[model samples]
Every structure is written in C-alpha cells, then in structure tokens.
Target chain A: MSTAYGVAAVVLVVLASALIGGFGIRLSRTTSDFYVASRTVSPLWNASAIGGEYLSAASFLGVAGLILVHGADMLWLPVGWTGGYLVLLVLVSAPLRRSGAYTLPDFAEARLESMLVRRTAGVLVVLIGWLYLMPQFQSAGLVLRAITGAPEGVGGLLVAAVVAVNVLSGGMRSITFVQAFQYWLKLTALAVPLVFLLLAWRADGTPGPGAGAATWALPLAGGREYGLYSTYSLILATFLGTMGLPHVLVRFYTNPDGRAARRTTLAVLALLGAFYLMPAVYGTLGRIYLPGLRGGDMVVLTLPARLVGGVAGDLLTALVTAGAFAAFLSTSSGLTVSVAGVIGQDILRGGVRSFQAAAVVAVVVPLGLASLTRPLPVADVVGLAFAVAASSFCPLLVLGIWWRRLTSAGATAGLLTGGGLACGAVLLTLVGGPHTGLAGALLAQPAAWSVPVAFVVMIVVSLLTPGRIPPGVARIMVRLHTPETLDLDRGDWRPRSS
Target chain B: MATRHDDASVYERIEADDRFRELRRRFRSWVFPMTAAFLAWYLLYVALSGWARDLMAVKVLGNVNVALVLGLLQFVSTFLIAWAYSRYAARRLDPLAGEIRAEAEHEAERERA
Candidate 1:
C-alpha cells in the first residue's frame, strides 16, 4: 500500500508538470516565444521557476543523507549550492542580462570575438548540462527502487518520458510554468512533514544528537592535510560554479533589466536558503533518530515514519515521497530544456523538429547512463557537476564578460586543457573502481586546480596572439548595458557588428 | 589653431541624439575590468586556500570555522558583485548606452536618406 501510494504520487506530479507545459503550448506562437517565453516571465514567476529546477534531486534526497553520514559539515552542500547564486547575482547576472544573450555560447562567442570560443562553450554547456542531469535521472531510479522495488530502468524510463512529454509540448514557455508549480509543490511537500516531525520532537522533549550523529558532525577524517585539501576544493567548485550553470544564468535573461536581474537573484537566494534549511533540520534529526540505517539518502524519505510511528507516519511518508518525486520531475524538466535547446540549435536541421528530437536525446542519453552506473550519493554526484561547472564554464563567463583581451584561442586552449582533465577525473569518480585516497581526492575534488589552469590557459593564449577583436564588441556592449525600460530599450536580441 | 570651428563641430555632435552612446563606453570601462576582477577573485580564493595555508584559519563563527566562512563569502561576494553591476549600469551605463543606441539608429537613418 505504501509503495502504491508513493508511485501514484510520483505519477501525479509528473503529469501535472507536463499538463502545465502542454497548456503553455497553446500560447506559444512565435519562435522567440518558444525559446525565451517571449521574454515575458515576471520576476516572482521566473524566480520560482528557477527554484523549482534548482532544487534538483540533490536538494530533495541527498542533503539529509549527507548530513546523516557526515554531520554539520554536510550543511555546506545546501549552503554552498544556495550561496552559489549569490555569486552569480554579483558576477554575471546584471551584465549577463545586459549582454542580451540567448544562451551561454552566444555570450562567449560575442565576448571573445571568436566562433571557436562559442563552439567550445556550446560543447561545455552540453557537457555540464548532461553531468548535472545524470543525478536527477539516477535519483528517479533510486526513488522508484525505494518505493516500488522495481528495476532501476523502469523509473529512469518513466521520468524521461514524462520530461520529454512536457518539454516537447511547450518548449520553455510551458516548462517555465511547470517548474514554478513544482517548486511550490516540492516546498510544501518537504515543509509539512518537517512541521509534524518538529511537533513530535517537542512532545518527546527535543532529542539530542546521538553517537552516530555526533561522529558525523565532527570533521574527523584521520589525515588533517588531505581533509583540509578536500574541504577547500569542494568549496571552490560549488562557490564559483553557480555563475556558469546554464539554467540559472538563463533566468537572468528573462528579467526586464540588469537591476531586475539582480533582484530576481536575491529572491532566489532567500527562497533557496529557506528550502535548504529544512533539509538540514531533517538531517540533524535523522542523525539522532535513525542511526545505523543504510542508504542514508533515504533519510529524508524515512524520517517521518521513524519519528511519528503509526498511520500518521505513513501519511507523512507519502507526502515526502510526492515531494521527492516532484524534485526529480522538476529538475529533469529543467535540464531537458537546456539540453533540448542546445541540440535543437546545434544539431537539428529544422528548429522545431530539432527541439523535439533533442528532447528525446536529453532524456534518453542520461537515462541510459543512469541504468549503467549505480548512482553515487546524491550530493556527491551533484558535487562532480559543480567541479565541471567551475573548471569549464566559470572561467569562460568571468573572462568573457570583463576581459576585452579574452581571445578565442585562449578560451579554446583553456577549455580543452581544463575541461578535458576535469572530465577525466569526473568519469573516474563515477566509475567506482579502485577508489584510493589520492585518486579519490583528484576525482572528487579536481576543481581547485582545474579552474585556475583553465583561466590561465585562456589568458596566456590570448596574449601570445594579438588578433582582431570582434567588430561587434562595441554594439553588443551597448545592448547588454542598456536597461530594457530605458530610452535605449530596443528589446532586440540581435547582435550588431559595429 | 582653428579652435572656434573645432569646438562648434564637437558641440554639434554632442547635441545630436547620442545620449545612449555613453552607456556602452561606461559599460566598456566596467565590463573589461570586472572580468579581470573576477579572475583575480577566483585566483585569490584558490591561492588563499591552497598556498597561504594558515590564512583561512583566522576564524569567525565558532565551529563555523574561518576557512568555511571565507569560502562561503566567495558566494556572498558574487551576489554583491552582480548587484553592484546592476546599480552601476542602471544609473550610469544604461543612460550612456541609450545615447549611443539613438546615435546609431539616427546615423543609420541618415545613410538611408
């Protein structure tokens, strides 16, 4: 009965997200509307949509598990993830809004004055999108395995189909609404049980951290030097990584102006920070209450039942199951939008057909990967995604925005140098064979070194060859700087060569 | 020196619809340097953590650990930087951009004429 209820709840959220998107298809008429929602999303709506997608499988399932295993130190995952946006808001949000870019590749090519840079960026965007999406797909399998005891493939297929249905039917216009709705659904689902559990705790005189929980909290991992290295590297990846995330950066483009973009980012910080806090509470609670339980990732799902213990426990569990599924559906849909967009533009011949085809690839490729690889712990998989973002796109965005001297050769050099190695390390980490201390460190925490090498390669290469800067630099600058409501509000997405 | 005529010509060009022109110029000033600033900030972060070993230990919130605090500040700094960009653009750069945009449009129209 519990499994059936959970599966049913999962189906409901997926259908709902898809249905919302399908409805948007009705309003989506123009190509622009299809791609950028006609640039009409309100700040609140856009923020919620961003949040819906941002709180991926990691936020829903993994944070608590990480806390269950690692203690307060794991709080960094949610904190860093939420905090990354603050970095994005400051570094790239407003200027990015000014840049009038349809995508990350557009920003890079125009900024660096090189088509090569754009292509490299295009490739990185797809890679980062895939790396990030893999976890969401894996989480789906994990969720189904927990609930239905079904083969992993069944859940991955189910989520992929649901995502494809929503994305192809509406493009971004529809997906935006679906994501916004899912954000609230995820929050409510997580929040309700938290309230009940807290009440239960109060009635039981507020329990203290247990032995297993206390150990998880203490940062005691034998070797101090290596532990320090691990801590710092993880920080580097998550902190700098947010600026380059395609979905997050894409939201700034929807805002009316640079100021509005910043405001939207602020809204997201508060929203995400609030949502993140609840998971820590679950994790802290899990440490005391559910010690020695395997599959810590299930901590979020298992908490209510462990605390309350009865018919009410079953009810709360069902609610959390629904929310976890919402997290999977919401994030998968968000990733689908970016992956589908890239494929449509770069690979497909006709735009709309390409979009539909791309949507299928977006879901299918990751689903296949999820089936083959036993998913890593949710937060850990998300961490790998961050390392890639930090090494590849972060350098590109930072340099592209402010460095007039950023040449295509430099970008290509850095991207290949930094991105190639990081890609190898990530694959090694995901492969799950021969995990040694140093190998584990390199595979798990490559960003600290990788990000710099990427940046240096771009700069040095650009300097070695003094070449023509893009003629469009000045004109593009004007578009990016001008506020939409200002007298220069051309609102045109075209890049002009001056 | 043909000062009067040169000054008059310059004044005439300025008086024409080039209000947004300044926006791009101001943007160029900020955008170029800001990129450098981020690179510096990123390097500063890596260097402080990797090479300057003892620095992050200069602590803040108890068990909140200074290293972790500084690391978290990196994220905070990103938000502040983005916010600063918006304010600078909205107040100074955007206006200049509008002037340039108008000048471009007007010039394009004149060429057609």
Candidate 2:
C-alpha cells in the first residue's frame, strides 16, 4: 500500500474536522450552546454524534485485534460495548437527562447536595477521562505508524493538537456535527471494504480460521488463570461503566428532554449495533487469512493489503486509516471537552476562556502519558478505564439516582474507596510486572470485586448516617424521576444560561 | 418569589402526592425488571463463554457456531429491548410522570402567587 493515500486520508479527516469546528464556533455564541448545544439536538443527530464518539479506537481497531488474537471469546468485547448502551438506555438516560445536570459533578452536587461529593466526582471524572484518552492517543500513534511508517509519537501529537483545537474552538455544540459526520465516515470506511473482503474470501474457497486448536473455536479457550472470573468481571465493567463515562453522560444532556434522551440512547444502540457487526467480520477474516499477524490491533489495517493487493488494497487501507483517525479525533475531542469542562468549572475560571485553556491541558497531559508509556493493546487500556468507572461513578450514579437515603458523606466515602481501589489496581497492572496469579487476575479485572464493594459500602454508610441525608433530597428526586413536559418546580436553574 | 419556605413546601407536597408515588411505582416496575433481566442475560453469555464452552461451540448452521449465533443475538436482543422500552415508556411511564410533574408545578405556582 502506498503511503500517499494513507497520509492524504489522515490530512483530509483532520481538515474536515477543523472546518466543522469552525462552523460550530459561529453556532456557539452562547454559554448554553457551549455546555449543552442549547439543549436542542434532535434524537437522530445526537444518536449519530454519540455513535461517532463512542465508537472509539477500541471499537474500530481494538475489537478486531482482540478477536484476531483471542478467538470467539473476544466477541464479548463488542457485545459488551454495544450492550452497555442498552443498560444505559434502560437505567440512566431518562432520569439523568431529567436531572438537568450539565456534567457528572453537577449531577453529584445536585443529588447528594454536597460540595465534597461534587468535588470528588470532578476528580474522578478527570482521572477516568485521562485514562480513557491516553489509549486514543496511543492508538492514534499506532495507526499512523502502521499506515505511514512515521514515528509513533507523531500520531499521538498530531491527534492531540487537532482535538485540542476542535474542543477549544467549538466545545460540545461544534463537536456534535463533527462526531455525527464521523460516525457515517467510519461506517463506510469499515463496511465498504468488508464487502470486497468477503467476496475475496468466498473466491478463496471459504477457508476457516486455519484449524485453530478446537479451543480457539470455543469460548474461554485461553486457559488463563481465573478465566471465568475475568470474563464476569469484564462483563460487569463494560455493562455498568457506560453510564459513568463523563463524555457519554455529557452527550445525554444535549437532548431536549428526558424523552429525547431516551430516544437518542435507543438510536445509539441501533447505530452501535450495526457498526459493531463489521469489526467482527474483519476479525474473523483476519484470523482465516492472516494467521501469523502479530499485534492483533493492526488486523483491520493490514488485512486489506494482504487480500486485495495493489491500488485497490491501498485505497481501502487509506479509507480504513481515515476512519481510524476520525475515531481518535471524535473520541478524543469528546473526552477532552468533558475533562476540560470539569477542570475549568471546578479548578480554573468558569467561562469559555477557561474551558479553552483546560482543553489544551486535558489533551497535553494524555499526549505526554501516551508517549511515555509502553503501548498496551488499545482495548485492554480502555477496559481498565471501564473498570475504574464501574467501580466509582457507577455506584455514585446508581445509588444517587435511585436511593433516597444516600448522603453526601456516604457518596464521598464510596467514591474514594471504589475509585481509589480501582485506580490502584490499574496502576499496579501498568507498573507492576505482568500479574501471574490470583492477585494478577484481581488487579487486571477489578470491577467484579470493586463494584460490589462500592455498593455495599455506600448502602451501609448511608444507612448508618441516616441524619445526614440532604433536606433537598425529595426535591432532587422529583426533578430526576419526572418527565420534562411537567410544569413542576424542578428548579428553573439552567446553570449560567446565556 | 422563590423562597426557602416555598421550595420546602413544594417538596413536601410532592413527597405526599399520590401521583408521585404511582409514577414511581409504574416506572420502577418496568425499569427494574428490564434491568435485572438484561443483566442476567449478559451474565449468562459471559458464564457460558467461560464455564459452558461446549454449549457455545455447538454448530448452529454452515460454518456458524452457537457462539456466532448467540453473539449476533446479543445485538438483536439489545435492539429488541431498546425498542420495547421506547414503546413502554411512551405508552405507560411518560404520561404518568408528566401528569405528576404538571400537578406539582401547578401547586408550586399557586403557592408562589
């Protein structure tokens, strides 16, 4: 495959994003637009944008790579990823949108009525956002190096610069369109090449994935220590973690009301389900065609060139490359905006200027970390972020939204314990040598243990400190659980509305 | 016009309101069961993948195993659940929640005046 096609595709995607960001600049003249796009995004467009941003490097490349390497068990990754939205649609979307909180911390402060809990949420949001963003940058580097033979750090730096610019210039209002466009772009990139790849496979007598020892054909084939425990833990993390992602939750706020939020989430489930099917095709084909390929993440990129050959293969590779870069840009921009919003609102000043400055900080910190760290497989790093989010914010959200007795003190304690434990496990997995035994499996997949512990601690603490329940709890609960068409006194506050 | 006493009274009224209770009951009935069922279904998939590998590997069609069909069904089930929720909410949950909200706001407005 020629380098020109790959580089040109990358350049075109960057330019298109920048152009869209500029248009968003004009549309975003008000504080409301910057925060929630004036809360006017329709369900279809919001769903597309959510699809655009949510289908990150992990979905685009990591799932294929995992399936290529791990066989049928890796199918669970995409399943869990899309299924997370189903969980979100059923549990969090309507109530969360009705809560009228712009960010996770806002939801925290409103529900628990405690500044301490709010600040704890803010810190966790930044930590999870950064942890999630690092992989996007690292995968950007990986994709760029694969396509153009550029130094790995260049891709991360390039993507970081583009994302910072996009977030700083447009914020959420601008990103909505950019991400929506990206969803379609990514779909075409992966899906179109897939048709040709399938035809090629059919022509080659429809060989199976090269006689994988029967275990590879089966689930949980890898005889890793505590395999069942790890699978269940991963299921817990991905299923519960979607509601807790700062970026994902922020998108729900863009919907006009709780109904629209629910509709948007429903749309997102469909969009993601359709897009996710294509990666499995690539992964399955990669296994049959390119069995010896190392670094499973590259399967999507390399398979086209191997099967199709010549200019057509190069063109498809470029298309996939463009799609991959768009995945990085869209997801990074979403994460950067969410992280910067929390940072700017809580730590810095409280306006667009502060947000712009914080956006730069948000991207730069992760960009540096991506460069410094040994690049883990993109999906593994993302799974670690999911575990941390599941342990921390999942507990906060589930309990705060449903249980009326939850106190600020209890929320803070739960966040610290669950979040701190998960973060420690992630750091251990990263810095400590490869885990070999029970300790390793536990650290490697902390959500199974950490999430339940967080829930118990929260419930017990809230039960003990019954008097600490906020006086405003009933009012907040009414606001959360009600529909928007209601003329209720759900606090007419629109947070520094323009 | 928005005072501390007014806010407190509004919440007190809502807490006592039968509409609020009924609304909560209806939404909870749907959301809670759906959530539990979905989680159980997901756990079953993961568990089968881990503990019941042979069951998952049973060939369902030409070249497609039970795992592949089940994996595809994960998407199908997600869509079906989402579609079901949309219908249920539109039909049952939303209208009731809206009525409670409207009544609460009406009372709050009366108090403010």
True-structure Cα RMSD, model 1? 6.0
Off by over 4 Å in 2: A492-498, B1-4, B101-113
Candidate 1: docking tier: incorrect
Q: How would you encode candidate 2's per-residue C-alpha lDDT over A1-498 as one tens digit per residue?
A: 799999999999999999988899889976677778988899999999999999999999999988888777777788888888888887887777777788889889888878899899999999999999999999998889888889999999999999988887888999999999999999999998998899888898987776763666577777356778888888899989988999998898888777787788888988999999988889889888888888789999998999998999999999999999999999998999899988888888678888788888998898888887887779988999999999998989999888999988889989999999999999988776358899999998899999999998888899989999999787788678755566544554354423
Instruction: Please give the C-alpha DockQ score of model 1.
Output: 0.14
Off by over 4 Å in 1: A212-215, A218-225, A468-498, B1-113
All candidates' lDDT scores? 0.73, 0.86
What tens digits encode model 2's per-residue C-alpha lDDT throughout B29-108? 98899889988887887777766777887887766888788878989898899899899888887788767667766777
- Residue A176 of model 1: what lDDT? 84
